[model samples]
Target: MDFFSRQESARRATARMLVYMVVTVLLLFAAVNLVLYGCLWLVGHHALSRSVWWWHQWTPQAILGTFLLVAGGSLLEWFRLRDGGRTVAEMMGAIPVDYATRDLAERQLLNITEEMAIASGLPVPSVHVMKQESGINAFVAGLIPEKTVLVVTRGALDHLNRDELQGVVAHEFSHILNGDTRLNMRLLAALSGILAIGQLGGFLMRSLTGGYDGRQTRNPVTIVWIFGLALWLVGWLGLLQGRLIKAAVSREREILADASGLQFTRNPEGLAGALWKIREQGSWLSGLHAEEISHLCFGESLNMQRWLATHPPIDERIEALYPGYLARMRQRQKNPRPAAPTAPTPPSWNPEGTLGFASTTGRFAAPDKPLFASPSPDEPIPFDGVFSSGGLVGRIGELRMEDLESATWLHRQLPVEVTRALQTGTGAKAVLYALIARFQPMEPARLRALLADRASFASWVEQVGGQMQSLDARFALPVVELCLPRLALSDAGEVTGLLAELNVLAMDNDHLSVFEFALLKRVEQHLRPKPPLMQRHALESRLQPVAVLLHSLLAFSSHDEAAIARHHHQLMSELCPSPPAIPDHGLPPLEALDKALHQLRSLNPDGKRRLLDLCARAVESDGILHIREYELLRVIAGLLDCPVPLLQGVIHE
Candidate 1:
């Protein structure tokens, strides 16, 4: 299937999730109404016949009971969120990511991720290695686009070579792209709510049992028996509801995900090989927490009971892929096709071919030698610009008028030297601008400088851009970012490393200013996503005001204080509805921010900490937590990760 077909499939998956949610909501509503009506009938049947007071007198009590049921359900959802992280952590910890007292299997995990990202047109996800298990298993978790985590068992990494690992990553990426992750998370939340009903019934039963005494058991004990019987029935009903949801929907989701994974990779052998290895090494995941994630595993994580199995039998799955393989196994038949005797057919295009010849063709004319030596100026940047207007062509119409209009705006008058300058801080702005501009042309002077700096062609873009009239800066930036993630890391150690690099770079030019440092922080923020709780509009709004302040500090203070305030306020309001009112000090524009920053910097050792704290407070100005706000807070926190908050000791310069 093409990209659009797969996207349509994902849409169908989303529709399925919505349908499940609606059904769940309807069932819960009906069940609660039935329970309420039954309770009201028991209490009001005699009262209605007497008519001593209004039969409507019992309405308030009935309403309260219904409210309690709904509140109980809401509480369950809250409880799951509170408990989810710990539960997942404890399960993961059971199978440690350490082999022979090592810190983490970082290299193998990273290699797999890099290969997978290369294969799939997606961002490389965060990688986690679980070392205790020798079983080949993997799983992915996260709700949003940014926070997805891809976890692999140590056995899979150590046992499977690079190709097999690539296969596994491809499978996980398929789950992410196909919209299964979101559906699975929703199911978890809904199931948690349904299960809470059983817990409530159990709680009531325990309380009643504890309150009963010896004398109460004898006289009119039938009421107590009936009450106990009702509680038992209700608890069982709740349990059954939870199980039915899991069995009916949750189990089938795995099969769909597996099929989707196969469709994405377009190579059944990748998965089949991994599965075959699992069987060879004994497919038992040796971890205490295996049961928690059993349903999400590539293979069975736990010993399956025939009735409660989430996944179909592995043999059946293999048979589905390799038809008649099971029959061959049963009959002990020999393979019809001989292995390794014939060479595989090659693709039509060969990379080694000359310019005029096709990629796969071996024949090349001698006249095309000069063309190969000095290729034409307009060469396509392959596997680049996959996210921009050029990449979106397949999804929408190819080269539409609106797309051209937008691409024209992206056209920059960048110098070719800007590519080389991107390696250092000197030409970062020009390169960044050029990158955002799709149709940018290089100036003559910039091209000459790039030709002179041929020795510093650190990456493919620099080398190619040096000779070309125009280059795909959009593609090059992401490639550089992916290849050099330390350029992206905002951890304390990483910050220190960057500071050292800056120190060396500024040896001849003297000290780096606060403005430069702030710019670097901004760039880093753009590269990484913030934590869920901190991602908010308030934080993004805070960026515009802060950006303006930084520009002013860099000797560009043309706008008045009122203008600045209006811009800041406008940004904040855009980010959050009903933004917190800003108090007017009637001072110069950005004076408050300048003062706070100066005070923060003068603290020397604690300067970074103060800045982070200030940023956190600024991000929460709207009094509501958002994901963007969380991300901004995290970026600032990373800039100051070194210093811990002190107790009695005041931080003075």
Candidate 2:
């Protein structure tokens, strides 16, 4: 399935699971109420008869009370997990991986994660290691990409080779990209609700039996005793249902993730080998909350019955990846051979700095230089290019294998200091400061005045600003994205201070460039604690506002006023048959544009898709994609939750 389909499927599964959970809760409610009524009949009326009239035992108050109790408990549990994936990680006692660690295994993990982040065009997720866990397992957790966390067990790091580790990390990335993380959170919430009743029951039973004290109860036939017994029975049943629900929801997802992982790495042997190691060794976790997040794990963390297993059997999973795995194992046993050592290969670079395909000769080679010619400003834009709104949606979380390889090459090509700076909080601040200072031409006196009191910060910016400015502008946004996960490690106060400094620098000249707008917008979106909620808006009612937003976008795309006007007319005509007049004012200021985009976010998916199509037209109207325009488009698409893939024939020059 495509990205949208996978997302839709996850939504459907969540809905179906919710329905099942509600039914289970109702059943439990009835069971609890019936038990209460029975106890009342026996204790209050002195009747032990099983065939007593059912109507006499039934009470509206009892039914309502039980229903409220169950529903309330479930909601409470759901609220407890509102912090999402980070909460789950903490529950497992996972520690954040230090990016500066010199450990080879840790460095390899960070490198693989960086490459994947670049390839997927998503922010690098926070990485954590389960120090006490000896399981060959890993998992990604987060309701959304910005807050996501990827966790690996120490055993996974120790047992898996680089390729095998890539396969494992890729599997977890599939979860993050496929919208499975949100679904997993829902599952965790629902199960906790169901188990809450059992926990209450256990507490009540313990109180009645004097289990909490050093004495035993004298009377076992009291109403409290009978109710406690009923609750105990109900609680255990809930536990059973919780496991069954997890098994039903998670097993199929595991298979799909395995397939996606293979698609990402194009290395079935690596994944298949990991599975082999799991079968021969083990993937079991000894953590406290292992059972709670078993379904979120890459491999089954608990040994469960077949019907209750969160993952398919290890053997079955291996066989699915390699159809004749059992036969291969027998052959290997009979004629074991040492694996050959492979030589490392360098990345291929083209003379024009464009990426080119390298031959599979285990050695890098330079490509022949091609004649370079710049397109004229008057060149006609290709209106007939293959552009699919649906195809764009499908590319949201999907990455080609070639992109991954390119990302790997790109990571190696980056300056070592720049890479190091992105890995820590202080360095991340320096990078951002340098990027902002060099984003546009700023008067030296004005900049110095703006930083008059902050000597240390100003010095750092001056030190790095030259290097940052000399680098290609196209890489600025990507580098900033790489720094976000680490920057997130800063305390709330530190982030607030950094954001304040950023805003000051952005507004120093009283005008925000397209690059500055895009940079600040993307950074704020990640750092801000509360994200804007998506709401539905009527396209017909909001057409003028959207047009004004599009006008601003077009104005930034080209310097030619006539060209901008033509592009605006073209897009308006396409969106509305009877085109509305362009706003009387010139290009809206950055603040106005920000407000317009915020309002446009409430447009329904179809409306957003149409807006993006108009955006593509505007960007292409100039017959060339400028770096600033490209960055703006990306920021807009990201805000709409409709990511566009890198366009063809668009160089970042």
Candidate 3:
């Protein structure tokens, strides 16, 4: 499925999961109430004769109390987890991966992660490592797109080669792209209630029997024991259902992620290799919270009944990734003797900068030059082609091997100074300040005041600003993306300071330059908590914001005035058949445009897809793509929550 279909399916699955979760809770309520009714009948509060119904012993108040107890437990878990991926990772004792890390394995993880982020056309999410874990496992976590994070275990890095590790990272990113992180977090919250009930039972059984609390109960120990045993039994039943639900949901997603990994790395053997290692050494973790997080793992984290396993069998996964893979492995194992050599093994992925992908090369084992080209900012690009509008829209939310190469190529093109600057929080904000300063020439004093008042801070911004002197316009988005994780690490005061200064700078000019707009707007989207996810807003009622967005986007295009006007007319006609009267204010200010983008984000997925379709049509009218148009297109798409592929494949043939 494409991005749109996957998004819609995720929404449907979430809805169904909620229903199942609620039904499970209701069943728990019934079981507990029946237990109470039996206890009451034994005490002779009511007769079980035909004159009185058995449910009479289960009072309305008791039913409401049990229901409320289960609901409250679930709600508490949701509250604890509402903060997004960071909260989830912290729960599992994951340490964040710093870009400046000295360890080679850690650095490799960062590089591979950035490559995948570029492929998915999203910001590079925060990466975390479970250093103590020997399991070859990983998972993504987050409630929203901007808050998502990727995590991997130490064993994964140690055991897997570049190809196998890259394949593992690709699988986790597929979770991020497929909206599985959000769904997985929600499932975790839902099951917390069942776990809580079981714990409550354990507590009662211990407390009443002088286990932990060490209290001697002299009155009615027999009744108390019966009640405690009943709660314990019912809680165990609830846990059974919870695990069954988690297993059913997690199994299918694991297979889907493996398939996506194959698409992304274009090396089935890489993922198959990872699975084979898991088969040998196992993927189970010894972390304190491993059981709680098992369903979200890349490999099955727990040994359980086959019917209740969270992931498919390792051999099954290997076979799925490469048909007859297990049998071939057994055949090789049986033949211990040296066999006659036939064909040399192909090299693992090499991120060497190569133009005209696919036709020019097949084997990437050994490249003559450095793995990638380190082009000077002034160096000419070998290709500058148009977006394949008629066909490429489907590339959104999809990552491929070429996309990974493009990501690596883009990473290498950056000057070392800029890459280093992006590693820190303040330096990242300073880099943005530098990019914004480049938008409109400002006097030295004015820029100093707008960027920072403190000499230490202002000097840093100016230093990074110097690095921007040789920067190309095409690199603007990348700089912003690299800044995301760092910016996320910055204090709220720093983020707010950056935003305040940006608005002051933007307002002084009274115009939104294409580069500045994309730069600042993306930063704001990440720092500011997005409005709650809601899809109830109708497209018909949002025509005006749609118009404002279209106008602001076209104004940045490299097309001639006549062509721009013609494309606008065609788009507006298709977008609004009846044509609601909109203001004729040629182009909106930066603030208005920003507002329009946010408003359009709530459009139903299909509505947003059509808007992109019309937007692509407008670009097609120009018959070519320019850096400004490309950035504007991405900015618009990001605001709509629809990510496009990075500037690599589309920028070439």
lDDT (tens digit, per residue) of candidate 2 on 1-653: 87656767787879888888988887777777677767766555554354343333455665676666667776886777676577778889999888766556676787788778777777688888998988798888876777888999988888887677788888988887677888998788778778776777777777765222236543443567667777888888888888888898898889989999988888777788788888877889998788889999988898888889999998888888878876797698799898533221112333333223232332223323211123454563442442334344455667767667656655555554566566578878877877878777665566667888977766766666756656656567777877788788777898788888888888787777888888788787777634435457766657777778777778776778787777788778866788777676455456667877777877765676667767766766655566677787778887776554444334435
In model 1, which runs have C-alpha deviations exceeding 4 angstroms?
1-8, 21-91, 94-106, 132-135, 158-162, 205-208, 211-214, 217-240, 243-256, 263-267, 276-295, 300-309, 324-653
Worst 10 residues of 2 by lDDT: 363-372
Clashes of each: 19, 0, 0
Cα lDDT of candidate 3 equals 0.73
Ranking by TM-score: 3, 2, 1
Error of 1 at 320 (Å): 3.6
lDDT of each residue in 1-653, candidate 3, tens digit only? 88888777677768878888878877887787787777776666645553233266465755786666667777898899877888888988899997666566777777778767876887688899998888889888888878888889888877776667778988988887787888888888888877666667677778775222347633565677777788889888888888888887888888888888899889898789889888878888888778778888999887888898999988888988999888887888788668533222222233331111111123332335533344554543432333344344676788767667766666666655566677678778777777777656555577877645477777776777776777766567877888888889877887897788887776667766777788778888888758556555667778888777666566555346676666677778876666544337554555677777777878877777777776666555545555676777788888777787765533311
Q: Please report, in order, the local distance difference test score of every candidate based on alpha carbons.
A: 0.43, 0.73, 0.73
lDDT string, candidate 1, 72-156, tens digits: 6646654554422223434575332221112223444553454344233344455566667777888776554344567787777
Of the pair 1 and 2, which is ahead by lDDT?
A: 2
Model 2: lDDT to the true structure: 0.73
Better of 1 and 3 by TM-score: 3
Ten contiguous residues with the weakest lDDT in model 1: 644-653
Clashes of 1: 19
Q: What are the runs in model 2 whose C-alpha is more than 4 Å off?
A: 41-62, 210-222, 322-326, 340-391, 442-449, 529-534, 538-541, 560-562, 585-589, 645-649
